[model samples]
Target: MHITSGSALYHYTRSGTSVKKLYEASWVRYCAVNRSGDKIFVTNSMSELLTLSKDGTILSIFTDRQLQSPTAVHVTETGHVLVCWKNTIIQVDIEGNKNVTSLAIPNVDNPLSMCNLGKCIIVGSSNILVLKIE
Candidate 1:
């Protein structure tokens, strides 16, 4: 599926058609469509963490006020969602609760994108940042 963000998620159809309103938010900065296309990982650049179905039904939302400028997000194999802010990264559980892990990240300059590669999380900023979490 081709994702073009403009306030919502759009899925490209096979016949050159596309589905609109897949997901709606004020600041949907980045989205990761799961390999199955059943679940979605969405980050609002100015708001909350959103987990939703392909049809736009929100499965959950994490309301932590710390979610400011959430530039990117990735879902881990262990089922945790990692959200990246300007200089920090936060983990969210399945229940939409923010995990209390140490928010300390060293020498980050404007984090911009991220991806989960099973065992570790690779983040992209002004430069590339890789964190190995066991």
Candidate 2:
């Protein structure tokens, strides 16, 4: 599934309809699916992270001002949710949706993208930085 420009999550299929609308939320910028692909996570511009069931049901919502411009999110094997803002990385509890901790990256500017690389997080914007979460 991918986020449309109108902030809608869409899953394209080869059936007659071609595309299926999964969920609609405001300002959605990034999305991540767990390794099992059962739970999907999406982050928006309003400093909110939304967890959705595979069938498009809202499971939980996490909001915080510190989640400013949450550019990316990933779920770890150990049931941890990782989110990246402009210059900070936040670790959250997957089940409780609670903020566990936050780490700041020095000299990071407008972080617009992120990805998981096994043991590290790849944050990219003006440059690429690899961060190991311990």
Candidate 3:
């Protein structure tokens, strides 16, 4: 998968065939595909989270007021969508749909990116933060 800033998201097969393309006018900062390969979560410069299908269809969009300057996104192995913005990380529980929680990471300043590694999550900014999942 590839994302072009202020443009679109492209998905290519292993053989280099372009399978899907999602066009967006906003500046796309980051994206994460779920473990099942059926859902794609995207973060834009406008602090919005866009949920799309594997075929690039818009499924849902989260534009909560608290999502300020979302810089990174990741999908956990258990299917939760993690969005990093400002000094906080918001976990969108996909199973419950309504269980959204925010976690404040100590000493994390202006987090720029994040990814899941086994049971832990690594967030990067000027410094790095590793959080173990319980």
Using lDDT as the measure, the top candidate is 3
Lowest summed lDDT window (length 10), candidate 2? 11-20
CA RMSD per model (angstroms): 2.5, 2.5, 2.1
Using TM-score, give the best candidate's number: 3
- Kindly report which residue pairs in candidate 2 clash with one another: none
TM-score, cand. 2 vs. native: 0.84
Error (Å) of candidate 3 at residue 65 is 1.8
TM-score of model number 3 = 0.87
| Candidate 2 local lDDT, 1-134, one digit each (tens) | 45555477776654535366777767766777776777888876678888888776888889876787787687776667888887888887775277888888877766777677677877888888888866
By the TM-score metric, which is better: model 2 or model 3?
Answer: 3
**Per-residue lDDT value at 78 in model 3:** 83
In order, what lDDT does every prediction score? 0.70, 0.75, 0.78
Ranking by TM-score: 3, 2, 1
**TM-score winner between candidates 1 and 3:** 3
Candidate 1 per-residue lDDT over residues 8-51, each given as its tens digit: 77778878687676776676667766556667777774567777
- Model 2: CA > 4 A from native: 13-19, 77-79
In candidate 3, which residue pairs get closer than 3 Å at backbone N, Cα or C atoms, i.e. clash?
none
After superposition, candidate 3 runs with Cα above 4 Å error: 15-17, 95-99
